[model samples]
Each structure stands twice: as C-alpha cells, then as structure tokens.
Target: MILCFALGIANMFHLHWIILFSVVCLICAFIILFIEIPLLLRVCPTSPAFDGFIRRFETNYMRAAIYFAMSAIQWISIAAKRTSLIAAAVMLLIASLFYALAGVRGQGFVGSKTLGGQGVAQMIV
Candidate 1:
C-alpha cells in the first residue's frame, strides 16, 4: 500500500533477483501476520489486567515487526549502498517511533518501568 509506494520511490532499477527477494519477503510477512491472528485471539486471561496488557503488547510488537520488514524491503531496492543504508536507518527510526508509541499506550514491555519512567519501549532491532 503506502509502504510499497514509499519503497518503490527508492527502487532505481528492476533487478529480477531483488524484486524476487522482495516478493518473497512480503509473502512471508503476510504468512506471519495470518498465523499470529489466531494465536492472538486465543490468549487466555488469568488476570484481567495482565491479559489485557499482554494482548496489547503483542499487537504492537507484531505491527513494529511488519513495518520494519517492509522498510527492509525498500532498503534492498536502493542502488547506492550508502544512501540505502541511510534510508534503512531512517526507516528503523520511524519503526521505533511507532513501536514506542504503541508500547507505551499498551503499558507493557518497558512501559513506565524501563527507559527512566518515560513509558517508551524501544524496538529490539
């Protein structure tokens, strides 16, 4: 969607192998997303609060992973190595921002505990 267009902007050439790799990555990502949905639906609740928190954290983590992988695909498309690296770095930053915001609001995984009570959780690469 939007991500595909953003990444396509950086794609300078239509290398068959790179395009193939990107397609494979995207397929794998979609598979992962599909598999996680059922598991998320089945997480049982021993405690109401803890259960709610876990569900939210899981959602955020999945979103971050998906976005990061999409950005990595874009990174693979750029022709200039240095420029690609920089673009990848920026993509990572944007992904981290999304992760932190989602994690903080979810109140799990380093929220209000680590990061100096800032309630922000960082991406795990």
Candidate 2:
C-alpha cells in the first residue's frame, strides 16, 4: 500500500496502472493466505511452521517487488531523484528485514535436516 501510494504521489497519471496492478496483487495474495485456514483441517495441510514462514516470505517478497517496481517506474517517469531514492531505500530495507527475519524463523521451523518420503506438498498456485 505504501509503495503504491508513493508511486501515485510521485506521478499520479503515470503510475496509475502500477498502482492498480499492485492493489489487485495484494487482494489476490490476501485471499490465498486466508483460504489456507480450511486446508489446515484437511488430511495433510502443511505444518504450521512451514506454512507460516512461506506466507510471511511471500508477503514480504511481494512488498519488496512492489517497491522495486514502483521505484524504477517513478525514477523513469519523474525528474525527482530523491523520491526514487527513498523508494529504493524502502525496498532494500523491507527486503532485508523480512528475509533476515524469515531466515531466523526458518531455521527453527524448517529444521536442520529435510524429512524425506513425506507426502507431496500441495500448492494452491
């Protein structure tokens, strides 16, 4: 949302498509994340730890992608370098923060060794 808003503020007419695409992606991501609940009750939903980590990773990745894309677009469309620099900074910050956090978490959740011969992991998308 922040990324989208920032792009709009940078150049409202130029970034309208980017903003729309970002919103649509966000809505789809939310729906997929929410839909995981029912799968939890099914025979072989992913372990909570793995699922949680995946969700968080995906969410943060999405945010970072939006920031990066918007930053590039704004930098191309607008003359102001400062706005682009700020967006780039925010992108780096978010990407680093979430990935670092995910790594710390995945260590505990993903376990040291992989479990072989487990059921096939089903992905919605």
Candidate 3:
C-alpha cells in the first residue's frame, strides 16, 4: 500500500525513473509468484521448514502483485482522466491490504513447524 501511494505521488511529478522501478517491481512479483513458489514446493516436498517458508513467501509476493496491479490501474486512470477509477483503485488496494494482513497474522499464530516431531522423520523417509 505504501509503495502504491508512493508511486502515485511520484507519478504526479511525471518521473521517468519511477516508471522503470514500478515495472521492475511488478515483474519481480510475478516471477516470485509463478516461478519461485512452485520450484520451492517441488524441491522440498517433505520438509516442514521449507513448507512454512514457502507459505509466507507466497503470501507476501501475492500481496505485492496485487498492490502493483492496483497501482498500475490507478496510474492508467490518472493518465486517461478517469478520477472515479482512481478512487476505485485506492479502495481495492486498501481491501487487499487488509485481506493479506489477515492471512499473515493467521499464519503467524499457526506456527511454521506444523508437522512437529514427525517432520524430521518424514524428511528422512
């Protein structure tokens, strides 16, 4: 959310550098979501430690992607002179932040070592 708002502020000045930065962030987010997560899962199918890390990793990148997408839409709206869509995009970004935060908090309480004592045994097998 902060990054989106910062990008919006930067957009107001019509900065060329921010455009490149935003594109890089968006591409990185997509790469994490589509490539890294699946590869991690495949490489550590039975490791509880990796499972927890992957879950948190996936959630964080998913939130980042949502933010980047919303920010892009907001930028487009501003360029097209559509004030209404800008407000809509801001609202969606807020909603997504809340939703993603809830998931993070839930994961925090659940603990990452879900398999407990059996985790090592499972990995050994």
Candidate 4:
C-alpha cells in the first residue's frame, strides 16, 4: 500500500496511478463481497425461521451493502476523472476502516489479557 502511494506521488504529473488505485480497490471490493460473503455463509448457519438463502441474505446484508457502496463509489470516481484522486483517497480511507473493523470484529480490544495467563501476552494494535 505504501508502495502504491509512493508510486502515485512519483507519477503525480500524469495522475496515472489513479487508475491503478481504483482497479486495486475494485478488486478488493469483489473479494470482500463475492468471496468473503460466501465463505462466511459456510461458517455460519442460516436462521431456522427463514429459508436458507433468505436467512443468509438477511444476515449478510449490512456487510454486503457497505462493500457494494465502496465498489460503486470507486467505479464512480474512475468515471469522474478530474477529481479521481480525491475520490480515491476518500474511498481508500473508508475501505481501510471497514477492513480493519472486519478483521478485528471478534478479537478483544488491544492489550487485553490472553487466555491461560501466566504473564502478559503482548498485543500490537
């Protein structure tokens, strides 16, 4: 990611890195929406009250909506051309926040105690 930013800066005269950045963001959005959602469905059971597909859809709607919005915004930025850089930056920040939230969703807060503690377990946040 730092490499992407460095190259983007180095090529600022043409603003070509905006294309690369948008493409990467689009790829990430696909993985989050298509790949991760299906994988999560396999891990988590559907609600008994609803049909399987409907339950899966209901359970995952918020995550799907967020990723879908991120993807739409990135694609729209690509089309905007003149303000693509600013758009990309905003989208990237949103993507980073959501990704980190998903990654840490079930983990205890940073610096929290570990199981079977004999001593403090180091945590890096």
Please list the residue runs of candidate 3 whose C-alpha ends up more than 4 Å from where it truly belongs after superposition.
1-64, 107-125
Give a tens-digit lDDT track for model 4, residues 1-125. Answer: 33324434433455455555555554454444432334333334545442343334322334445545554555555554654445445655565566557555753322213321223323311
**On residues 20-72, what C-alpha lDDT tens digit does candidate 1 reach at each position?**
44454345344333333423223332455634533453456665765576556
Give the residue spans of candidate 2 off by over 4 A.
12-80, 84-88, 107-125
Q: Each candidate: RMSD to true structure? A: 11.8, 10.3, 10.3, 14.5
Q: Give the per-residue lDDT of model 2 (tens digit) for 1-125.
A: 44534443443343345444334334433333333233432334567775554355334345445444444443443343233434534554565466456555653323211221123244332
Ranking of models by TM-score: 1, 3, 2, 4
| Residue pairs in candidate 2 whose N, alpha carbon or C atoms collide under 3 angstroms | none
lDDT of 1 at 110: 40
Task: Give the winner by TM-score.
Answer: 1
Model 3, poorest ten-residue lDDT window? 109-118
The CA lDDT at 119 in model 2 is 37
Root-mean-square deviation of candidate 2: 10.3
- Relative to the true structure, candidate 1 reaches a TM of 0.36
The global C-alpha lDDT for each of the candidates, from Candidate 1 onward, is 0.46, 0.41, 0.48, 0.44
Per-residue lDDT value at 32 in model 3 = 35
